[model samples]
Target: MRNYVGAIAAVCLAACGEPGGTDVSSAPGALELTREADGAASGAWGQGEARVRFASRRVESGVYRIEVRQNGMSLTGLVDAEQGVSSLDGFAEDNGQDTQMLDGDRELLAGLYAALGAELPAGSALAPELKYLRRAVGLWAEHPPAVELQRTVMGEQGRGYTMLCGYAKCNGKFTGSCGTTFNWYSYAKHDCQHGGFDLAANQQIAQLGDHATCDGDELYMSGGKWVCGEPDHQSRPKVQGNCFGRCGPGCGGDTQYTVDATNHDGCVRNGHALTSAYCNDQFTAASDDELYAPDCY
Candidate 1:
């Protein structure tokens, strides 16, 4: 999924600033998707500067024209429910003063068109048709969870450390893959001492270990030792007070917050693995590391 944090930043840079100059400190909050009695739908996030408006009017039997006004750009698409197709027909800017061919990812517009055509009744009023389109737009506009990163910095006089420091490194890595497998194992009674004997001849059984001597991909160093095991982690110092910041007036920066380091459970956001929830969850999925019986270890 495309990173919408960048989108919010773009909107803020364009409109969210101190009255005279461009200076912004806050990030946008969740999108506000709303519908009007006229069946027109609008979604605004990142304050009100970044906005999208959807309006549709039925043409004839299972066909409708969709107009999307997003920020300063206007996109038009046609939906034919009977044919099960949606296509971007035109694009314009500055209230249609400048027109150009539609380009780039028009899936959002097409999806909205198809959804509207399928849901809205024939000859239905504009308001009801756009209401459904609003929901689709809202889903597409849903923001990923805001992640907060904590960095350690020495306090003045080298006394203590502050938990929240600097920009908080908004962009961070998500969990990829994880599973603790042991390289340690034991063999049972195998009488393969003779060259004529098979390697597995008379091997009763095998044993596994609970502790991970080394991972499958770990390389062996001198003295037959693993390069490393699970690295040790230091516990975080207890934070005394809450840390909260607000966005500038009329900006959508309020919905943005830092994600704690421990919330990676593999759950998805915006149809993408933006967090480490999946891999982290796998670490605990199977608690029994020993493949064989406990006594076999």
Candidate 2:
């Protein structure tokens, strides 16, 4: 499912360079996040196929331990009650985009594409769109939601993917990569935390260690503050970068926190009883708010 605040970013590499060897093993109900690669693929170092997977087990009510394993890399971390403070903390800068990992979480999902063994569109095909969109927003120069949490790249092909829509199609339109739908004001104002996004460009730049100038969106910041507008690829004939970012000084962490907490508390209270009633309807499943349910099993 698409992560809310701690969705994915700043993946914390364990000291032992492997998952179980890290703190995740100590969690009360430490469930393995990613499944072990099939033994058939074991000892096969040059497979060249990139697939990413992760999983988490609740340690207690409102608490979880998460881990991501892909290629030969692994990262482990925990999600505390308030969704702030994670061990995978880090700051990443690319192109003109600047993003943070975990406030406790901002882009744990980006680690997916970073390590994905999928068939990626050529960088050439990826550049023009990025170049165009960057120009559209006057090259806003701030990349929000550094990680693209749209699909889990399972293999080196298009069919080798799945959607992380924790709820249903969020906002009735934009698929939460932050915003790709032309007029995403509703989504930006309501559902950008789902950790999914729609990229107009057929090609995407794996911004982790392979990021080029062709990543991020122009609309991410306009005269300061998160906004949604102009040249939406899903609407207009241009590409738009509808990415979100982590908590920080000018990033509006305080306001976003207030908005998030209010919605989360509402869900923690009675969202299950009232479906589609609140804008945060998906929080129960997406954010694992169901853990707060009387019978959370």
Best by lDDT: 1
Work out how many backbone clashes candidate 1 has.
18
lDDT of 1 at 52: 40
Worst 10 residues of 2 by lDDT: 39-48
- Candidate 2 regions exceeding 4 Å error are 1-48, 82-84, 90-297
Per-residue lDDT tens digits of candidate 1, residues 58-151? Answer: 5556544445555455544344434433443223453344343122223333333333434442234534345324322321222122211111
Residue ranges of candidate 1 with Cα displaced over 4 Å: 1-48, 95-297
Q: What is the lDDT of residue 194 in candidate 1?
A: 24
**Model 2 C-alpha lDDT per residue in residues 67-115, reported as the tens digit of each score:** 4444333334444434323232222212222233232222223322222
